[model samples]
Target: KLSKRYDCVVMEDLNMKGMSQALNFGKSVADNAWGMFTTFLRYKLEEQGKRLIKIDKWFPSSKTCSCCGQVKAELSLSERTFQCECGFTADRDHNASINIKREGLRLLA
Candidate 1:
């Protein structure tokens, strides 16, 4: 359904193994089959003639403010909310998603 709605989809190239270990997901990480899911999604999107664009893992999407384009030097993972000096406050994940969208669009351009 989502693949048909959007011609292009963007995703960040993440370090899944490290993340799973660091986040202590236990058996859940392996059980979830994220890799398999991604593969399935890729095939499904391809079948629909849609695109899946993967941005670099090193891109600081989480640390960058979506509204002001300010990049913070350090943003700890413990900080769930992102508060920028430019008066932009948003959930960390939400801000990252916005930055990811912008970066993906830039890549397309």
Candidate 2:
């Protein structure tokens, strides 16, 4: 349904194995079946003649200020809000989503 509805799908090219090994929630990550899900999504998109754009995993989507394009040197996961030095503040996930959307659109262009 998603493949037929959307012309393109954007996703982060995450290093799942490395993440699972580095984080404490290895078992939980493995159980999520992210790899399998991405595989299925890719095939489904291909079948519907849609494209999947995967942004670089290393891109600092969470740490960068969505408004000013300022990249922070450090941003802990505990910080739920993104506070930029330029006086722009927003919810961390919302800011990251904006960055992701911008990157995805850039790739499409």
Candidate 3:
């Protein structure tokens, strides 16, 4: 689905293996098959002139509220959910995905 809908993919530069040290956090992240997905996207996109963009690990995509554009002062790794001061609530990964998509688009344009 992601491949069909999007021309390119963008991801965070996370140390996925290190992330697994946390209880549920590490396991779930590893389960996402991010490395495999990125590899697949890279080869696939290259065939079509598309590409993948990688944002920095410290990009603050998760802590920055997409709606209000405010960067939270405190966002811990233990927090799997994002609670924005602006009342925007979203899953941590989802929120980061949104930010990544936005930033990736800006970079492409």
Top candidate, metric lDDT: 2
Better of 2 and 3 by TM-score: 2
lDDT of 3 by residue, 7-73 (tens): 8888887778777775547568788897887788788877778777888888989889988889999
Specify the poorest-scoring 10-residue window by lDDT in model 2. Answer: 22-31
TM-score for each of the candidates: 0.91, 0.92, 0.73
> Which residue runs does candidate 2 get wrong by more than 4 Å?
none
Alpha-carbon error at 52 in model 1, in Å?
Answer: 0.3
True lDDT of residue 25, candidate 2: 73
Off by over 4 Å in 1: none
**How accurate locally is residue 93 in candidate 2, as Cα lDDT from 0 to 100?**
92
Superior by lDDT: candidate 2 or candidate 3: 2
Clashes of 3: 1
lDDT of 3 at 6: 71
